[model samples]
Target: MFALCDVNSFYTSVETVFRPDLWGKPVVVVSNNDGCIISRSAEAKALGIPMGAPLFKFSDFLRQHGVQVFSSNYALYADMSLRVMTILEEMAPKTEVYSIDEAWLFLQGMEKLVGWQEWGHEIRNRVQRETHLTLGVGIAPTMTLAKLANYAAKRWRKTDGVVVLTDPERQRKLMALANVSDVWGVGSRISKRLNAMGMKTVLDLANADTHLIRKKFSVVLERTVRELRGEPCLALEETPSARQQIVCSRSYGVKVTAKDEVRQSLCAFAERAAAKLREEGQFCRCVTVFFRTSGYDTGGEYCSRQGSMTCQVPTHDTRDIIKMALSVFEKIWLSGPRYAKAGIILGDFYHRGVAQPGLFDEIQPRANSEALMQVMDSLNQSRRGALWFAGQGIEKPWQMKREMLSPAYTTRFSDLPKVR
Candidate 1:
């Protein structure tokens, strides 16, 4: 059997973890640029603030309705996610982290040991007890069905927080009730085409002719349909492949009122990306920096800018990435406009410890490039932050502010929130 475990209102839940005063309040987590609602608490959902709805569009309404808003605190959220996953790892034998807030666990042959439904409840209860955040769990024979069951648990079985689709009849009812668009891989475009062909619900698509689907859709979609019907087409990767690219970005606490601040922010982001690249055992040939002005039309002037640099030699060196990112910022940073957000992206990556022999120069090892990186990594890890980079300095006054952020409830000992 397969199980899909999803965090309930992950972003908002992360914020509420430390700020227990937010319990039962209408809370919404804003997107990266503080642009829109990405995740909402149950209270916010009850008030009908639609997901992905632009913050500017409903700012007044949110204020009037007393909705608690928060900037996305990825540091707090990621640490909490790690704690949640750690709890699950201790309980489940085999688990795959699907995303920041979701994981799939293989639970084959466990039904005899403990009934699947009761086991699921125990898992959910344990998660809540350990981490305050609740989970919605779905169990089925296939990954697709597990995902469907998870969604049903969230949308319909609100009180149960867990759902199991072991019986064929039960699966059929869920498929009929769920729209085709809500299926795992079916995006809006595919959903529209399938709906046009009179396949509006998941059951219709699942029962549709396989040959016709292969002719219309790709082999991948065909496999998804079969997987939806209870076959496990994909096996969880034991060691999931490393990320092809890495991005570190954030909406400024306040609009960047000047070009120097923008460049500084970009440099800081690049430093983070470089550290992540080394952490993942990867190096990049190209780095890109992007910045955008606030979406809010308080408008004196607004502009979005980006620049990229390609290195002759791919390196994961923080110095190299930061220099390239700054160069990119030089091209993009405009003096007059107030900028809202900025990010650094490391792309064209290759595995670390593998250096390409330069066409111009023989592959000669730098005397201490790798050693320097190791020292830098160790220093940062030990200090829990940048210890040597006095050159880059702390963020500027106009930088992104997480003023209302909750303390690190799970990761940092000194900063952990106290339970009342």
Candidate 2:
């Protein structure tokens, strides 16, 4: 059997973890730049405040209802995620982190040795006791079914945040209750098509003929059908592959028209991408810089501009990447347009290392470059202070707005809550 463990309303839940006053209170978290409501607490959901509602449209409504709002605190969220994953890795025989808030645990035949519901509740209780964050636990024979069981666990309050689907009869009952769109891989468009064909629920899709599903849809959907009927089609990846490219971009909080400000933003993005590349233990061979005026109302001749430059050798040094980013920015930076967003991409990663440099390659990596980068990374990761390239600018007027961001309570020492 496999078990899927997911945090309940992760973003808003994280907010409540460190703030005792927020317990049982209606809370919501906004997306980048505090644009829209992305996460809401159980109380907020009960009040019928829709997810993804524009904050400006519902600001008055939320305030009138005593709902708390906060900006996206990515630093705190990421640190909390790491803590939760660490706990799972220590408890489960084998764990696959499915997302920031979901993890898969493989129990194989161990379910027979322990009572299913007892074991599920054990995992749930441990996570809640340690992290002060509630979890929904679902146990089933297949990964897809386990995900469905998790869905049922979260909705049915009597489960007490845990659901086990070992019996075929119980699985079908829960599947029948779930809409087709609620299935693991099925989306809105696919669900609509299935609805038109009289398959409006998960049980309908499970009863589908494997051969017919394969021919009508795809091998992937066929596999999903078999998995729904107690066959494992997807297995856990012990090591997920690194991304082919790292792109860092953000919409400016305020309009930017000056070349100097755009240059600072590009440098900041390049540095962040380089730091990620190093964290992945890989090197990048190309750097791309891009900037654009608001596509909605930019009256400029060109709405966007981008250009790329390659390196003589793959490198993860931030200075090297920043230099290349500046060069590309110069080529694409247009004057007199109100820039609304800027970003940089670092691509062409190498693991086993790239081909040898040419005999006459004029530029070479700096001496002791790797050691120098380690120091910078160490200081930055601590979060107390960071050493940035002077080009990133001390006063970043073009940064994304996070006016309601909470402090990094778990990640930064200065933000730690006082006992009193």
State the weakest 10-residue window (summed lDDT) of model 1.
Answer: 357-366
Q: Flag regions of model 2 displaced more than 4 Å.
A: 211-217, 293-302, 360-363
lDDT of 1: 0.83
Residue pairs with colliding backbones in model 2 are: none
Stretches > 4 Å off in candidate 1: 253-259, 291-307, 327-341, 356-366, 382-385, 388-398, 401-403, 418-420
In terms of lDDT, model 2 sits at 0.89
Q: In terms of lDDT, which candidate is strongest?
A: 2
Per-residue lDDT of 180 in model 1: 96
Q: What does candidate 2's lDDT look like per residue over 303-405, in tens digits?
A: 6899999877888989999989998888777888898888998899987356676777644667999899999999988753378888889899998888899
In candidate 1, which residue pairs clash? 252-400, 253-400, 253-401
Q: Which candidate tops TM-score?
A: 2
Report the alpha-carbon TM-score of model 2 versus the true structure: 0.92
